[model samples]
Target: MTRSHRYRSLLLAVSIAVPAALGTAQAADTVKLGLVAELSGAGAPAGTNWRDGAKLAVAEVNAAGGILGKKVEMPEYDTQTDPQVSRALVQKAIDEGVIAIIGTVYSGSTMVNMLVAKQNSIPQFVGSEAPAIVEKGNPFVYRTSSGAQKGVPALTPYFKDTLKAKKVGVAWVNNEFGKGGRNVFIAEMKKAGIDVVVDAASEQAQTDYAADVAKIKSANPDAVFVYMNQEESARFLIEAKKQALPMPLVGEVTLTEAKVIELAGNAADGAIAHVGVTATATEVPGIAAFAKSFEDTFKRKPTHDAIKGYVGVWATKYVTDKVGKVDGEAFAKTMHGLCLKAADHPKILLDTCWDDRGEMSRPSFMVQVKGGSPVVIGTVPAN
Candidate 1:
């Protein structure tokens, strides 16, 4: 080729290479987001699932050119499902300059981190569904998952109308999450004219639940509403089964976790539960595709923990990008009035919105374990 032809070719190559290099440079610049999860202890299943979901959201946002023209980076800390450990991690996260925070599967841990975030003026998304977390008047703390007050509305109706259960029993872990769920469930049951025969509470991270199970067995209610994390709940269910306590079992969202079913086996079959998001409930915009992507990426089906975690990241991003800044004050303002629609992502189970209390208003799906998987039975409206 002639000199002029070679010069033209070289110019085209430079033009292409320069833009690619610029894009790579832009992608390297990042804004840090802190993530706290229970990597060990009873809450590991939920923590691991949440971690995968958040990572997927971050990857997708970065691939699409990131938020505010800066690649988002998540620096994670393990809480070991302990409130004290989570408290320390929250301070560390703020000190390390993460713009926002996410997670802590247990309500007790989330409460600790939420207070820290509030004190530090850092925006945090509490992964637990305890009503008390948001009711604490923390402006910096927001929730993507609905708490017991919101989820139990559907649960009580299912017990009263669908199952036609009159007498009921309640057993819960004695924590903020359990208390919130227990209180709301009892109130709703009363309104629906269902009698709560027995109510019991146990310490968190409980292993042997023979005594507790015995109380529930003695109550002999037509249906039971249990409030505990997956691991402990599995143990409780196993013990209940061994004692031949055969009544219709019902529980909170954690009961639908794969780990619970795996541990409880046939004991979990025919169990009813209320969950915000499930692989079997496809109400979100791109749920089918998201599930396929999640399975392809993690080699497991996404659970309520994963779905909520993914939504939390996107919800944070929505506010961050909307305000064109990732500051705590701006986020607090934008997130309060923000209402996201289902068209945003198919994996999102409900249209996202928040009330003045910083609690989410999202629908819950009533599901039953059938053939070793949760099957959607009904959709509960968000009150």
Candidate 2:
């Protein structure tokens, strides 16, 4: 070949290679995190709040400067509240090059998808409170709130001392979240020498709770412990109100969430719960500011799931900064036994600690529905 032809061929190779390298560098200049959650289907209330809260935190993070001096990019994938779909989405997020994962708020979905994160050695922050999520020994998986094992036992005192009940009924959705909470509750009741007069299991997204409430009513327990997702909890409360079941209705977590109260309306009144987190705890300056900001942005009150998501992202940032890099393995290693003080990292919004198992510990609340709203009746110290 001629010299000019050879020179042109070399120029073409350089032109192609330079842009490819530049593209790779550009991509590497930003940090991508996946927000995978149940944005639709039965878990929408919790998932949407989670997504919005993460988005809010991401915005603030970017405004202040991003993790490790790289811009933060969050790509969202809707899980549709299906466990298998959530598992697939987690894999997809990792395949797409996300440094970390935030999502699958439904415990069943989290249980299925968290393995994907573990396999990839990607740190995942979840809003799921199922004790089994941490029990699996996945170092990559972490909770934004306390698990049922920790939160439900706090209710034992309320049931045995406050209610003074010898008999209680249990109504739980048969998902991982419900099952874990239900199991812990039953054990606690047994320890307290309280009898479970009725134990009813409902399905996810079960609209009609007439039968479940009927069984609880027939048992005539002193109180009914309602352990279900937000929508199902609302439906159960409405049905219980309609049947005029005279026993007190109590629950943990989902029962007193903003979305549940909104859906159940007056039916939610007189309901009580032990919540790992609540937006109504305005006594905390950080939470009050977060709730107001969330309300202003979303035009609705934030739920406990929202706070979970917000803190999850901020905790990601806090720990990432502590590690001084975005390495997923390092992030996971740093998270175990790490404690974040709100005084140091205001975005975390609370003083929080994590065990080696990635379970979270923070102050919680005992809430009651009054005047169609949740009011914090007491505080539960961190476990």
Candidate 3:
């Protein structure tokens, strides 16, 4: 965000903060919800969408006369897209005595604060897709989106059964997001009896990826899966195009941001990306109405992070309703027991009406660049 935009957002946040405080003050039987996420930085695009989406929902819910008998009030924290900072914000939200807390968007960020949430017995709903995130099996914390394990297995079938690529190469940034993506993709590929040509590692902080691309080109794989965030993705795409690498490039959800389009320019044309089809609330009727309201209020499309942040709040609302209070034990009872399904929910990718311990049953699809816009190729599923 530019200096001017940051100031504007800060102003907007301050404005929202004042009303939230007043609203909380007026609460007799109202629910106080806190949304914590990176409201600024590179993650801001997605983060703000979540902040605004949750805000939109709270507004509507309050207009309809709140949950659990009183009006709903949301006090938000901007984690600035850093895991360390998100940890602090979690404690801050807890100290503020919020009934339930709604955010902490990224897998890495969510991972940082999971302990705080567990210790406090706070009900936290996250939108992170990293498999290791919930591996701790903290019953107090719930994810709305399927973990990377569940989401990426579908990509293997697309490669082996649909595209029929005999040999695939991987160029992934080394991190929870990238590492989990590769592990899941590799496991599925092996199960399908596919061969791996090049398994190269790339750093998310690197400025140039010419070396990685050259290595992949030398291996001459049929297709390449790039697991990287938008920043590294742009650099790789531009450099890959310049080097004229011919392999089809498939990507993880990290590349599905508007930042990729902005940074990669036309180089983004052929990069295929896999994302949760319904992470944002676009599919929700009430969420759709909230979306329009968000655009009217915030002047932008709610990115997946925004949807995730919004999901945290909405998830709390659902659980709180079931528990009839904001206690942690009660919330856990609802999360593990309540079969919440919202196709229109901001976190529908994590929403599983019927879930088990193995993997999620929701559909994950592969999308390709068509005429400069992304279009679904087919549903990528677990085989």
Candidate 4:
């Protein structure tokens, strides 16, 4: 070959190789996180809040210098409230090379999609409250809030000591989240010597609660436990008001959320719940600041789901920084038996801990809706 031809060939190789290496370096300089959520359909209220809260955390993390000196990039994937769709989106997120995932607030969807993250060795932070989400022993999966196994049992004392009721009615959505909570609540009720006189199961996105209300009213229980998603909880509350059931309405998680209160209006008043996290706990300076920032950015009140997403992302950053790099297996290892004190990490917003199975433990709240807002009536310490 001629000298000029040899030189041209060498130049071509250098031109191709240099940009390829730079591209690889550029990609490595940013931490990519997958945000999979039910951003549409039935779970939009919770999912959108979660997504927005995570986005807010991402913004703050970048502003304060991102994890391990790499900028954080989160790409969102909408699940459309379908379990199968959530699974697909999770797989897509993994394929796109996200080191960690924050996701589907719906427990049903999480149950189906979390496997994708597990198989990929990516740590996932979920907003799901289903006990089964963490019970299956997937070390890569973690909860942003306590599961039903913990949150529901916290209400047992309320029923036995505070409400002092012998008979209660249970109304729950027939999804993974609702069923897990219902089963735990039923067991707790039984242990408290309370009888479940009426058990009503509704579907996801169920619009009618007339028959459910009638059945509860006929059973004449002293109080009724409502375990459903946000929109469904509002619909049921409105129906209960229409029927004037005359029993104290109580719930966990969704019942007293801002979305439920806004949707149920006056019907949300007088309802009480045990919430794992609440944006209305203004007494906590960190939470108060988070709520204010969320409201300012989104132009709406933040829900517990929002708090979950916010803390989930901050927790991701906190743990990732502790790991000192973007290694999924290392991140998952660090999460088990991990505890973050709010005094040390203000972004975590609470003193939180996780067990070996990735279930979370934190101080929770018992809230009552009054004057169109959820008022924190009591605090439940972590067990």
What C-alpha lDDT does candidate 2 achieve relative to the native structure? 0.92
Residue pairs with colliding backbones in model 1 are 284-346, 285-345, 285-346, 286-346, 287-346
Global lDDT of each model?
0.82, 0.92, 0.71, 0.93
TM-score of each: 0.89, 0.96, 0.82, 0.96
Error of 4 at 346 (Å): 1.1
Span of ten consecutive residues with least summed lDDT in model 2: 324-333
TM-score of 3: 0.82
lDDT of 2 at 234: 92
lDDT tens string, model 3, 80-100? Answer: 888888899989988987776
The better-scoring model by TM-score among 1 and 4 is 4
Query: What ranges in model 4 sit over 4 Å off?
Result: 1-19
Summed over model 1, clashes come to 5
User: Per-residue alpha-carbon lDDT of model 1 for 211-305, expressed as tens digits?
Assistant: 98889888899999988888778888888888988888899798867778888898787778988767777554466667777899999888878
Candidate 3, poorest ten consecutive residues by summed lDDT: 351-360
User: Which lDDT value does model 1 have at 137?
Assistant: 87
Model 4 residue 299 lDDT? 97
lDDT of 2 by residue, 1-383 (tens): 89999999999999999999998998888888899999999989999999999999998889889887878999999999899999999999999999889987999899899989999999999999889999998999999999999999999999999999999999999989999999999999998899999999999889898898888999999998999999899999999989998988899988988899998999999999999889999999999999999999999999999999999888888889889977878988899999889898988888899999999999899999999999999999998
- Candidate 3 Cα misplacement greater than 4 A, ranges: 1-29, 278-294, 342-351, 354-361, 380-383
Clash count of each predicted structure: 5, 0, 8, 0
Error of 2 at 282 (Å): 0.7
